[model samples]
Target: MKVKLMTALCFLLINSGMLNAQVKDQKMGELIDQQFKFADQQYKVLAKNLPADVMPKTYNATTDKVVTSNTAWWCSGFFPGSLFYIYEYTQDAEILAEAKRRLTILEKEKNNKGTHDLGFMMYCSFGNAYRLLHDPAYKDIIEASAASLSTRYHPAAKVIQSWNSSDRWVGPVIIDNMMNLELLSWVSDHDGDKKYKEIAVNHANSTIKNHYRPDYSAYHVLDYNMETGEVLKKVNWQGYADESAWSRGQAWGLYGFTMMYRFTKDKQYLDQAIHIANFMLNDPNMPADMIPYWDYDAPEIPNTYRDASAGAIMASALLELAQYSNKAESKKYLDASEKAIRTLASDTYRSKLGENGGFLLKHGVGFLGQNSEVDVPLTYGDYYFLEALHRYKEWYL
Candidate 1:
């Protein structure tokens, strides 16, 4: 009798496991199909309205206007990435052909001396497109951009300088620079250049040591003494001026450290990523969906606006981090990310099919300076949302 009972228990466990696996596979297929349909429709509309000559330029959705101002260098990456996603999902030759044409234009713009965003603008979009397509022209363009970016490394300060001009940000290394390290690491592996890897590692080490607070939240910008290689000031350039933590900066740290771990397999980087993620997840003031306001501790919480773009970007990063962690608590983080994506897919933050000038996301902040795109649709928000959805389908179904 005991032997028969044990046999029944084992059979039940095996049957349950099989059922779970089948459910996961089915959910993954559903998510992928939804994304493919959405991308197909979006690409057709964009291609029909947006001129081919302006293939990679930034545009404003509120007024259905093209941005003729100084180009938003890093922000333009979303356009190419969006198109590439459509190509990946649909295998439409026309979409891939258009992506190649736009990337060629971006390659020419890299020759300009004032561009400070080679990684965000080119590598994330065109370089990633190349990685997927295995095209030689994209490889050549990425290599050249890597060389140009490496020139900004200051041997004295042991950090990469933030901006090209001698303006307010002169000699300062902003937190956003952390996101650029992946491009260098990618270039190092692709071209067999050790210097690029060295620079990336050195910059990451310096940032981990100095930029992060005990809570795992980070400053918006850190001004370094260029000569002594010492920390000068840690200021909040984007959020409340008095040392507040910007939500997107935390997302960047979470995403950046995760990428570093991916490249180096360093436990410390993964630990830092986990720590920062915990801070964001456990903060009492964070919204129910795990999305946060521009500042976590901002005053007037009721009126404070949410940055959906940050939530989307962090969800993608958290999914990657979940694959790397062994602790049970890691599953909690992954679950939270899944919930966040579900919230985004709901009606609250995402634009309807034909609303808001055919935009994907509803509330995104751009260039705190101009306050131009506050609470409007943004290209990066859409790209990151799609990316999170894609990752969700891959990991959790």
Candidate 2:
């Protein structure tokens, strides 16, 4: 299976900057055609199948079930966000209407202070809406969401809280929190308050100090002694163990720091992004096709299930990373990203027509340690895959 997947993604290794080369090559042309065709078809099916108000997380093939959540769930935005991505790609009228409907429903969550995924939920949905349409209402929604997210920041901890003081953790700050900085940074630059950007940079610097090990691998969660402003413990909530590198967590860190460098032109953040990318691409366990196991430390090793979502996120981040680096460094990052994109575009990771719960990508592992949404199609898998496609086209095509 892995061998075939690698062969399929080989074209992704072709320099997409050579658009003329792709135009001349019939095989590469066919791959691009198939990819977008699959994207459009998946969205059309997803638009009809998904419930209007609920957001999909994953599908259980055995139970023939679509596991879903309300607006309060951390993953709630990806469903609408994926729609906006498809709408942008296809320009289909029905997709646009469906995306708008879901975006409106998602806009209500802007003020929810209970969760740290406001960036994933509000920023991904409304950010795209505002970006594409320049809607003033969407801008307001994002600002409110940023304000709500800002409330999660603890002055002493200097980091955004991932979850409230739960029974298992006290003021947990997860690697996933890195992703929320983009929303904060965006709000600050768009004629909004500077406090947001300041908070974001503080959080990034703090995470760099406390959340990373010597090898640059990140911990999934950090428990803080907020009153004392100390890191209480490094632990794992979603990973295999405290020291294990969770695949999605690594991707979040990579993407977040790369984005930070883009916004602030901070060489430290860019260096961090490059360091993390080097660790990932050089890891002995990374598959030949560039898709990663759910947890880098999983005992299962070669047999462990793959997380296409992580690959998608990593690819998108590396595309941005390529743009920020010098020529020699940029080629290495871009090549790595292109390899992952090809693997994701392959049938091994992508869903077959009318299969896989109407999602574009498959084989994503979400919280396998908790036995939740393990080895299933994830909404985020599709969302970031679309984002990777757009980034590739924007920079290389």
lDDT (0 to 1) per candidate: 0.72, 0.84
In terms of lDDT, the poorest run of 10 residues in model 1 is 16-25
Superposition TM-score, candidate 2 onto the true structure: 0.92
TM-score of model 1 relative to the true fold? Answer: 0.87
**Candidate 1: misplaced stretches above 4 Å?**
1-28, 55-72, 165-167, 367-370
Assess candidate 2 and give its lDDT. 0.84
Model 1 per-residue lDDT tens digits across residues 1-397: 2453355335433443343333333454675576567666665655555565554333465367644322345666667777787777688888777777667656665554355577777777877698688878777777777778888887777788787546675567878888888888998987647798888888889899989888888998888877778887788888765467788888988998999999999999999999999999998888776767767877856355577788888888899999898878679778878766766655566555545544566666654445655555677777777778777766776
Model 2, 58-149: lDDT tens digits are 88777776778888998888987877777787787788888898887788899999889999999899899888889898999999999999
Cα RMSD, each candidate: 11.1, 4.8
In model 2, the runs with Cα more than 4 Å from the true position are: 1-30
Clashes of 1: 0
